[model samples]
Target: MARPDEHIHIEWRGGTCRVKWWTGEYLPNGRKRYESKGGFLDEETAMDYGRDQLYEIRHGIHVSNRKGATLMTEWLDDWLAGMDHGHLTERGYRSAVENHIRPYFARKSVADIDVLAYRAFRKHVNGVLGTGSASNVMMVLGMVLDDAVPRLIKTSPVERTKRRGKFTKKKKKERKKDMAPAVVDRLARNAEIFFGFPGYVFMWTMAMTGMRPAELYGLTREYCYPNWPGTDPRPDPDEEERYAEDLERYGLGDDRMPAIRVERQVQYSGGELQFFPPKYESHRTLVVPTFLAEMLDKLLASHTSRWVFPAIQGGSLGAVNFDYRYWRPIADGVAERSGPRVRRPRPAIPAVPTYRGKRLYLLRHGHKAWLDEDGHSKFAVESRMGHEVPGVEGIYSSVTVPMERAIMKSLQARWEKLQQDLRETDS
Candidate 1:
């Protein structure tokens, strides 16, 4: 009988046997491919390695056994081609792959990206792009590796780190997103200076409603009122129309009962504008304070465009277009600009201490904080924020009419107190 080590070659070079064997694969040019392990002291060690390699291949766990060991760049392209995510998500993943990932890891075969190599890449990304971007890039890379498992890679090298003995140094403090009602009022008042009164209303609405920025940007006049004609009559989304309260049938129902439907948001994808349902499709009705409801009524009456918040130049605001011209000045306040663009253009707005250097998205965070402060039910709060609450609590609990009224009442009182404080300051 032929020995199992027949195909394995042993080269004696005055030290040890160099065992080499054919790998049952061919190059693109039809050349036979091989794998070798050199400097084996005994034929037993050499035989064991060759047998293990053969076993892995037969069991379909050998990475190089399939797809001829695809290169990282080629595999990334294949993976991206198969993605069916939303435009924004697609854009981000493509950006990570093209800008950060492909440049560093492209030349390597997918099988060669072992745990050590991937960890080094992680450290490099964190050092170069900072935490937030590194996190997103790593997410894409993890998914890419995971998809190649048992094909181009036997196991994914992505490490899901445990918190034990990690980062011994003191971490940075968590950023506070809690904003008092007065701080919101100040931001709104300054927003009027930079943009128009719409900016003022925009600030208030964002702070109070907790809608995502895109959701608010896509808000139309038709969807802003409690009686907005889209959904059928029902007390709760999961309930029957017979559960609709009598207070809902009449005009302007309860003063504290104005609701806005969160059906869609503005998405700029593929170099064109698009409308998509809210993130995670959390289409919901958000109750607004009576005063905010009144403001929307007036805003709708005067505004000619379909959008509740149109660009300063007209039409729907392109995503991130207003950052330099509108959001920065509104958030950080304009002190001065030293450029040769012209002359004395002092368009200054007082900076709110709470908002300085903070993102506009924090307003959404502040709304959640406010809701928590008011001790509202988690179900009601999560529903208002367009978030899916997890576990059995989410399954059983529902937002009722009383919860909506209570939220509206608290918000109205805050606004009233702010107004009172402002009046007192003037007096």
Candidate 2:
């Protein structure tokens, strides 16, 4: 009931139908490749399999005969070895696979991972890690499955939950955490009192510029341009107009000030501290106020090491070192002093929000907020923060000299106020 050259044949073997098929096309050497996969209880199923194979072969597609019995752990090792992401990204992926995924899915077949299994895995991870960290773990898991493709699995099991621009329940409730400017001022002032100039300069620079902690640690004397009359690397397109308007108040060409070129960031990988490109390759130059420039100069003059904020012994300062030794003590001290209105002497307080369990990155967030409060244009703000503005805005807009002066003036006002407060306190 079939053509003589059908390229497919069915035969009964061991009480089941065995289907054998040839790929329709001849090989480069004028020979055909054949494959056999069978043991169908019904001849119809075997015939159907043969038909699908023929269809795929005619379309010039390589049909995968893989049974997908490869273990998840085995596949992950191979996938990780072939990954081309950055060192930090590679570290994160490896961490997720080893710490979260492998413990449960190691021996399981890669094909067995479905949405249900992933959901259960997500729930387990959420229990042990914070919500954000759990989400990142799931993201890495999804990437792994995506790489498997049709060879290992028919389709990726990790279906995107929603389309872009669509908000979920969590999105509605999520808030941008920040400390008040006054709180930042107090913290910066206290940092100097407790740990001296390094602490003060570090705190104030982070508050003013919104540089990432890694960028702050990566700051070197060479990159700190305390005096530059030339225009910034990313000059705004409307600089001429903005400059004209600012001429009356700020005076043209008087906008030159100190700047820091954010070229690289410090990363802890393979149990060692090293420097790498900033996140999103956001290489930028940040203009700063005069007071901050003076402070930076002072800090640099005081430290013999290349790092603006070197460790006590030497080399780049670690995040753990900064947090435990400097940031935590200052935060704890502030919390202890800022108690209830009751005038009675308070006992040793055990707790405060600890900046709502946020890390040093919050200073960057606070800086962005400060920019927004001062009504700086979004283009300038995003540029300063090393964030790419999406769509037409990013392509069309640029950072201007006028914009820099405006931000500098705004931050300078805050610095003057902070200095006045510190002077009053010291007196």
Candidate 3:
């Protein structure tokens, strides 16, 4: 070892000179670690190489010797296990890593992945997977590499070039615009035929309350209107005084203002369903029109189970069961399936004319559109949609009793108008 200002050690090899420089780090055995470059034609050239390595070491951007041997698969395992993300998210990351990412970069070391290597992986995923899946896979890869910066590699190579910006939008799938409320009603009518009365209730509640599908499935009799003994969304001890004050100003009672508490959703983790908070932890109460409130009260009376929107088979509805058994038959006509038939399909149930091949998630989007169309307060609309208002608006504005009443009135009027339209058609 020598002083930091002195030239690095150089030695004569078989036909050329070799250089080795102290890395200012030590091994567990208390021996100094050295970074080396060999087979240089002369000592000056070798000394230059040694200087660059020392500079990198000094700047805290030095790549370790083992980096060249650190395979992509090895890094993937270490990175995924370091954090405990939600089960669904972990599952998605693993799917992309194993099925798409690992296969291509498995043998390659982390140090070898550069911008060109990233572009190749991006092209491969786009060619093999759908546009959405490709985007997700790329995102996962970029995240992992970005995490490796300055430790396993100097910097992430996943750069979005101008060429990428030009073609990516063209390659990406166009998002479907929000569905019409009338279309949602048509879908509900079809669902009623397939999944009994609860089926009808599920569609309307989703469209009206803007609850996510999982939230609706996890909805319980206690959270829904007219059955909850008391109205206490914020139940902490410290909030009691504020709540009583609200009661004075807003008549905070279950009977006074019918609402649903967006508490939790069912998440499939490990092997069974577990209760998890709503996405973004958007725990808020949603006011429902009086008509819908009465309808829920009637349904909850005969329903013995805890779930508000139980499956047709009499259990809490899961995404898998809902999509194939209940939703597809209603969204896409039962008789019009494309895949090879296995068992005898159920008797033909006609699809909703306007919602053919559309997703149930669209109903939530349409709910937002309806709120905007009605010209409700931004704070109230975002609160109802389970979305946090951004910037100062979220900080200063709050959903008041008047806002909730206005929303309820607007929704009720929409429902009444639709009923009138149906009656006119029948006449």
Candidate 4:
């Protein structure tokens, strides 16, 4: 038996390997002693393990007859690795750990993490990062720690931590300028001039349909038609001829009509474009207005690829890179020519405002605003936007092409009016 503060050595195989168990001074107060265990194949290993066990015993982490020891980094790695192959998407899970979780707590011992430290981390993140971003980071941390609790590690420090108050009640004020008609005109014109007709049409489609940028990029030729040959009655002669002309002009071979499908989205991640699932509530379709149908036919005639919009990089256009260096300057020039200056104003403190440089998502917002202003039913708007309708609307109602076509027509009218206003003001 080993008394507190005394180390007992054990000899194995005629002292070829030595092991030690001890009782050590208690931690925080440094007064009492507690039992600890350590054994090793080598003198160095024994010394290291003994020293660590003694520390744990002193700190009250190693309890009587229980082996409680694992490095925080080691546990984290195992936990993350296990999750990577599980249901979680590898990219998102890795990002959560790499960008948020591991960076803060990787080096600290699991026992050293306390509620106070966690609360402080949350506060720092909220102050330095925006509340929304901080919330997401906290969510990731919470999830990982929750999984860790009662499994690889003891109770997580995050479980006891509460997010700071100010962030809870904050609702971001919508920047009214984003959905302003003038901004759309400028963006639409620039998209047309620099990216070509398909780009222009694509921009408008996003505006009218409220489809996510990824959804717009994901549109295939098959998705343009509401019905396939032999499914619904063929378009009237004039409409058929118009479709034929549009298809031929764009050089899209033979097939003219197919059901519009939204099965995939193009995402630019890791410096390249990759197709992925559409954003939450983004996998949807809307009927094209006659004019838009005509425009789409014309645009498709000019494109050679199967994609509705393809990159010109001499390969299949998988993702539309939003970070293309040329996009901003071209957009700025068009903004200058068409309407009020759209440059993000610098804050007095020179810090980037939360709303600054988020013009890319504005097209979608403008679309929603247009729908809301035109008295489209909330369900219809939610369907087109791919957002889950609330309550009974989601439970019972279904959206059809006629409803969507009507929405498109309304959007087209609004867009034309804005364009007309722009031309008049310029002249």
Candidate 5:
């Protein structure tokens, strides 16, 4: 039996019972508002359960406290502002939020985003932007929701979606392939024309030294001196002789061998060049060959700034600003002209979108390959490149300056041979 005034009633049959709540009758638009109380074996038990649920809802105990009206765009803005600035790279964070995340979900309300809608968004991102980009978007969304879980947001649709697949695996494959030395050289040669000799030097240095872009840009004239006192005191007989020969050959004093001291990096944050410690290995010194030393000296003398590679703008180089304005265009130009060495082709502008093209970060790869081919010990290579070797190997082995100098000499000799080959080809 049901009371007309009471919207909820319980019915039992043998071992099962149903508790039903009649929300209302059909409206003029043929829509119905109905609430349900699930089946239970005992009628009285079902009624009691339904009453408890109703009481919880009335008291706002079980109700979601999240506001349904908050737009995705608003949430994103707050998330970005609240993020740990030190943990996230400025350029990367900006790209993920502005270029990908906001463009996809800005107009949608948080409450309207269900699992199905999220899946559709993921599909759209994958189909149009590619899986990697879509995955990045999902990552950002997940991070935002993770922060919001304890606060205003109750559910995160990003958590429910499938983000990884063949596409992501393929992207990783492409990255590893791009790290080859030959690819780096082609990229460097092409970029040389636009960035000038300094740009070429900058790219090569990064490849060989494994110094971050900002560290390369932050190099100073004082840091490139031959007698850098901070260098490790290990002596190398072969390197000592080679360095002496180079100093004499160039009529340079003991001050000619280029020593690199990394005190800070130039980064663009908040629309300006900001000097900070290098992203990873911020406070270390590296020694380079005389040829690179001379190039750096000339660049420093001409630039007249604390920075080794100053922005064309008014101050020190900022990685993001410099890359966007200078490095990317040069990289694209190089990628267009470079291919397999078996066949030469005329240089042409790339037809692909600038944003969608690939540019190899060659300096680090070139350095590693050159060291490997020249048979320099891995410890020597790691030291010169300022990389911390993994595991017990790093703990037991120490690198001396003499060993570093020997490695540099070998690298320099190879570079000189390459220059001769280039000259012969030109002639």
Candidate 6:
């Protein structure tokens, strides 16, 4: 028999009794709430727990009484729906969920998540997606668990320092290789000749400015000051202020050099392209080499689109299309060595050294290396790269005009030397 006010039941499984009780509560949408306690020696202990659970639930405290029956998939759905994350971040998280997390642990109880289970999951992910993607999947899972702490889950099983897979900080840093100056020249020249104007400007700007791909893709005519101090509209008041005192000392004006104002980046989110601020809100202006400035001025004179580097087919350039269709072929070595190598219909190019598996981002790193070689201040270098310098140096030190001028001078010399080499090669 059961009390009429509260619905309670007892059952036996494998010579053990368990108790289940329906709390006299309903969801806003008219669904009943139920809880259970199990694996007890006898009905007496089970009923005691059942009564305790019912009391807790009735009084509006339900976390303690949760039976860990909530499926990971269900909780993740709720969590993801409520999260206010960036478009790319949300897309990646959803991908991790759909591709790896859901298939392995969606049906499992969150309470059952432990170190051993996470290790097993890591092995599975590594086996299928390899270390890089597996690393991203693990990070997403860790984020979900972190959010679930003391609510849906007891603790996060994924340790940031663990060596389960090859997914570690050191390994990630080790994977990024820098490009040589000659290599960058080759890439830019190949891009200009093979892919035309958009590719030409795109490669040159990325190599010289060290701007992120999203930032480069989002470059608009309005933000580019190809003639800078010599010829431009009203100067940016904030940028002027940042290096004003230094400029006064160096007898320089705001428009002394060509520059690009990096404010927002393009993101493909929610099945549409949207413009937003740079990652970590790193907004700054980058001074360009004189040669690049002249080239960009020429480029701007020809085109009328708001975007400086529009796609080849007349829309926004996507990262995937740019890498596979444009960069990959150039990096894998183009026809540069002889008469009419009819590989892909292009003619009269020489065979160059192939750099297989080299990434486009290495060009940006090469720019950083150049700045480093030129002995620029750490703060200035980091600022130019659109990265926030950590600790006290970032807060105190400022980018001086002399520092900017020095970097500009070095980059200009490099570009001039490259042009001379290209001219000599043509002759």
> Which model scores highest in TM-score?
3
What digit string (tens of lDDT, one per residue) describes model 4 on residues 274-375?
Answer: 667676625554555555666676777886666676544423334445535324533444232333573433211211132245556666777788888888
* Cand. 4 Cα-lDDT: 0.59
Of the pair 2 and 3, which is ahead by TM-score?
3
CA lDDT of 413 in candidate 5?
Answer: 77
Q: What's the ranking of the predictions by TM-score, best on top?
A: 3, 1, 2, 6, 4, 5
Reference-based TM-score of each model: 0.83, 0.78, 0.88, 0.64, 0.59, 0.76
Residue-wise C-alpha lDDT for candidate 5, range 1-427, written one tens digit per residue? 6553276777776668777654344657887544555559777788777676556545544323234457878888887887665433656776887987788777887666766776777677778776677777777666766666534455566646346544443454443332443444555564555544556567656765667666777665555543343332324465576445434433255543466666667666676657676665436656677667766666656655655555545355554466666656655543445667834344553332322355434455556777777787788777666677898888898766566677679767766776777789799
Model 6 misplaced regions, further than 4 Å: 1-62, 65-67, 160-178, 227-255, 334-345, 348-354, 419-427
Q: Give the best candidate by lDDT.
A: 3
lDDT of 6 by residue, 1-427 (tens): 6563357789999988878788666779898766667788888788787877666556655554464557888888888898787666777889998888988996688877888888888788878886778889988888887887667654567677765456445444545555555666667667766656767778888988999888888877777765333222334676665445423433255456668877779888766778887877888878887788887888888777777887755566753466777677666655544346655355333323545666777777878988998888999999999888889998899987688888889888887787788789899
What CA RMSD would you report for each candidate? Answer: 4.9, 7.5, 3.9, 12.1, 11.5, 5.9
- TM-score winner between 4 and 6, please give it: 6
Q: Global CA lDDT of candidate 2, please?
A: 0.75
**Quick one: ranking by lDDT, best first?**
3, 1, 2, 6, 5, 4
Error of 6 at 217 (Å): 1.5
Name the TM-score of candidate 5: 0.59
Error of 1 at 294 (Å): 0.1
Superior by TM-score: candidate 3 or candidate 4: 3
How many clashes (backbone N, Cα, C below 3 Å) per candidate?
0, 0, 0, 6, 6, 6
lDDT of 3 by residue, 330-358 (tens): 88876732346744334567777556677
User: What ranges in model 5 sit over 4 Å off?
Assistant: 1-78, 87-91, 98-114, 128-130, 150-169, 175-204, 226-257, 298-303, 310-360, 374-403, 419-427
- Model 1: residue 9 alpha-carbon error in angstroms: 8.7
Candidate 4 displacement at residue 130 in angstroms? 4.6
Runs off by more than 4 Å, candidate 2: 1-5, 13-16, 23-41, 60-63, 162-178, 227-255, 334-356, 418-427
Model 2, residue 335: what's the lDDT?
40
